[model samples]
Target chain A: MFARNRSGNSQVLSTMKAKQKRYEALIHAFHADIYRYAYWLVKDQSVAEDIVQETFLRAWRSLDALNDEQAAKSWLITILRRENARRFERKQLETVDIEDVQVHDDTQQADADVSDRELHRMLGGLSDEYREPLVLQLLFGFSGEEIATQLGLNKNTVMTRLFRARNQLRETLERQGENRGRANG
Target chain B: MDELEFRRRIYADPEATDKEVVAAAKADESKRKFWNEQLQFDKQLRKAAKVDVPDDLANRLIWQQSANEFARYQKRSRWYIALAASVAFTVGIGFTMWYHQPISIGGQALAHMQYAQIEESHSLLPVNLDMVNAKLASFGARFDEMIGDVEVVNFCHLSTVRSLHLIVDTPQGKMSVFIVPERNDIRVPSEFNDQQFHGESIKMQHANIMVVGSKEADLGEMKNIITQRIQFSA
Candidate 1:
């Protein structure tokens, strides 16, 4: 009778362990956002996918090091950026074509469809220096401080880049609008 | 505020307080409109980059984890089997050595000397003669010119117990015998076992022996010769 009770207790313990493992595997919940952040940073779907895949692989090995569930997205982004930088350090990647920088999406983003094209185009037109901070702050919704930490820049520098990026985009849009008016007038 | 300073504060943080943004906007009407447009653009950009992950990525990761576990299991199993096989092989060898043969003491030394003598003589008769000498040597007996057409010979020790051996011959059909010097009971009477000299036990002076050989052998004559040569006194 005691042996049966002990076995029953062990089975319960094992079930609990299994449930915890299932909960831990819930990293998939954030994959979409993480991919989006990586895609915004690199501006190439294939490279972004590579970065995401590498990030998740490393995350699987070091999942125990991750403390909070809420921090997982940011932690994954940090890993993606580091992996992308390491790739660059190892070998010079071919320059990505601006036209091909559109992120891959199977689902129709009904809300963002029209504005998303313009956003991608505007980002492509900007210099890499301004474009990176813009992507980090605006697209991924990172705070200026978070962007500053990720890019290894001072918060002041991040703020300056973000300001310049917006001003530059505004100026470019205005010029394009004026040109279109002349053609239509 | 100048157009530049007002634009700086607006774009520095997309989610900055409306009061701070409006303070800058109050200084410059055009700059305020520019901040509104930029904020809209930033929001659009954020919307564009929001990702939707595939449903299968989770299942793939789970499968990979299982594969890693299986690989670990196989590696551990191989080591367990190897450990068990090694232990079994050692145990098997130990059991085989235990029950097989009783070790004879002084047997190896006697065999070594016999091998040396056989190599030197190489003759069937002389080799048998050496065997007789070997047997006699155990009892501290000596002989000068004992002759026989000897055949089979063995001078191996029976453990540490006895070093006595045998030499057989076809002498006078079959008879070149000797006494053990230990038992002399047969010498007191004309007491003989069996017919003729085929199997004879005789006591001559100092010892007794039962011999087996050819029936044509002159046992009486051989006994008389041995009795004359042997000394019973000491």
Candidate 2:
């Protein structure tokens, strides 16, 4: 009885250790992209980092529910999206206007081109409906169907949002280019 | 595919490998140029979206998780400690209450009669008036003179109320006298008994005097003697 009890306790301990290892691996693999997605979703770096931390913490708590390793990316995104929605629900009045907050990255701003800065600000200025699908495509390389599934939207809607998102950005860039060209001329 | 359909698909996904869209791009030189330009634009958009993540985020996450787990463990064990402390506190209160439970004076005097008999046999020094007075001084009372032939006198407890016991021999039989301090919480019953002896109590100035003897022995003489002889100082 004593030997069996010891073995049972050891088995539980080993399982906990394995879960921790898997959790650390998940964090290292997805933290960067997850943070970027959160940043674009909220248009605030600190809030994005907070949401990412909360997402990973929640993921750690429910890591056992995740079975397939392939679904991990979408799973993390799902948690992050929910975390963002909950943030709005918790602080509805405190939601920051996306246009008011610049997408600030000190390291990128240090050496990025003038056009790149304008593009970054334009991306941040895009509404959540358009920017979300585009960010998923650009960052995780998720297909339209995958973004639709992650966002709980139809594939056609995801495709249309992606199309409009790029079209709006292209128009903005072209207008900016013309203004700069005319000024130089 | 028409130009509008081609541009729509290409805008949605610049690297659209759909055969129809690819074929349309190849058949029209302008369509091919637009697709390539969109592709280049998508590359820039991808770059803008790839923001820099903080350097120590991974370490902070792992550290925070472990700290949370440690806090949860501490909270659980603290709950158990609180439960055990309250249990210990309850048991301690129960034992103290049981130890100090009230007892009837007559019943205790009768109970002490058996032990008094054994004590009478072992007692070597004959208890005198002065020796009795010395013990009674603590209760602020003393006997004016020897009340009876006190064979043995000692202090004893009747349900946590300290008192003095005096064993005496009389003409009728042996009688036991108990001088219990007056306490409002302790009830001094006027009469009580067991198989071997019966007892009676009298309320005095500073104490209650209980007299116990055999069923046939008259306790009135001992009660009267104790009442008249014992004195409480002002």
Candidate 3:
């Protein structure tokens, strides 16, 4: 009886170890991209980090439910989106205005080039609806259909948002460039 | 495709490899130039979207998971420990209750009377004097002669004290005699009764004799017979 119990305990231990290894691998492979996605989603670094941590914690809890390794990215995205929604539900009164918070600090802005900071501001300036699909496309390289499935929108809607998101950013960059040229001349 | 349509498709996906978009780009140089510029802009957007992740974020996630799991395991084990302690405490209380409980030989004898009829039906052979003596000898006591018509003779325990039980048919009714060895802890009552039966006990040299019968039966006669015929060896 004792030997059987020991073997059973060891079996449980081995499975837990295997699960931990898988969780670590998942963090290593996608934590950066997932964090970046969350950053753009909330447009706040600390909030994005918190959301990413919450997302991975939830992922660890339900790791066994995720069978297909290929589906892990979208699965993480779904969890993150839900976590972000829950954040809103919990603190509806303390909602941070995206426009008020600068996307990058002054020190980081000092290190970046002029065009980089302008692009960052433009990307951050885009509304959540337009920014999300573009980020999914840029960070994850998700196709129109994939973005639609992830965002729960139709393919045409996702395509339009992507189109308009880039067009707006491009138009702002051009208008800034013309102003810069006039100042230089 | 028209210029506006071409620009819309290119703006939507700079890397659009659809045949129509490619053919449209190939058929028009300005459209092709516009697609290249958009591709360069898309590259810059992709680069900007990849914000700098904190260096310790991955370690923190793994560490947090381990810590959370440890906390959960501790909670579960604490619950198990509490459950085990309560179970052990209950068992200890039960054992103490059983150990200190007053042993009532007369009450046991009365309770055994209900099974007396069942025992009578199960006994294959009528117990004679020798058979009764054979079991009574274990208590260092025996009957000199036949006290009555012995129906069933067996050894039983009355409140953890070993005893000999003999069911006999008398002129009054069926009576059960229990020959329980004398123990300091056991309380052999002088008289006891329940709704169905009443019992009388007698303390001898080394054992207690409890005679029980139905409420209507006279136990005095059966008690007198057993007391007169039984002898205890010193």
All candidates: TM-score of chain A: 0.74, 0.87, 0.89
Screening candidate 3 with a backbone cut-off below 3 angstroms (N, C-alpha, C), the clashing residue pairs are: none
- TM-score for each of the candidates: 0.54, 0.63, 0.69
What tens digits encode model 3's per-residue C-alpha lDDT throughout A92-135?
63536555665444336442244555577789889889999999
Clashes in model 1: which pairs? Answer: none
Error of 1 at B83 (Å): 8.2
Q: Give the per-residue Cα lDDT of candidate 2 at B182.
A: 85
Best by TM-score: 3
lDDT of each: 0.60, 0.86, 0.86
Per-residue alpha-carbon lDDT of candidate 3 for residues B66-96, written as tens digits (9 for 90 to 100)? 9988999999999999999999999999999
Distance from true location, Cα of B198 in model 2, Å: 27
Give the 10-residue window scoring lowest on summed lDDT in candidate 3 chain A: A104-113
User: What C-alpha RMSD separates each model from the true structure?
Assistant: 15.4, 6.9, 10.4
Docking class of 2: medium
The top-ranked prediction according to DockQ is 2
Q: Chain B TM-score for each model?
A: 0.33, 0.58, 0.58
Instruction: Count steric clashes of candidate 2.
Output: 0
Runs of candidate 1 with Cα error greater than 4 angstroms are A1-26, A89-96, A100-114, B18-22, B25-32, B51-234
Model 1 Cα lDDT, one tens digit per residue, B1-234 = 667666688767757766857787777778767777767766776765564445665565556555664787799999899999999998899887753444422223223333332423233454544465565665655444354444434443333223333333445564424333443121212332323334344554344443433445556655554455434434
C-alpha displacement of B198 in model 1, angstroms? 48
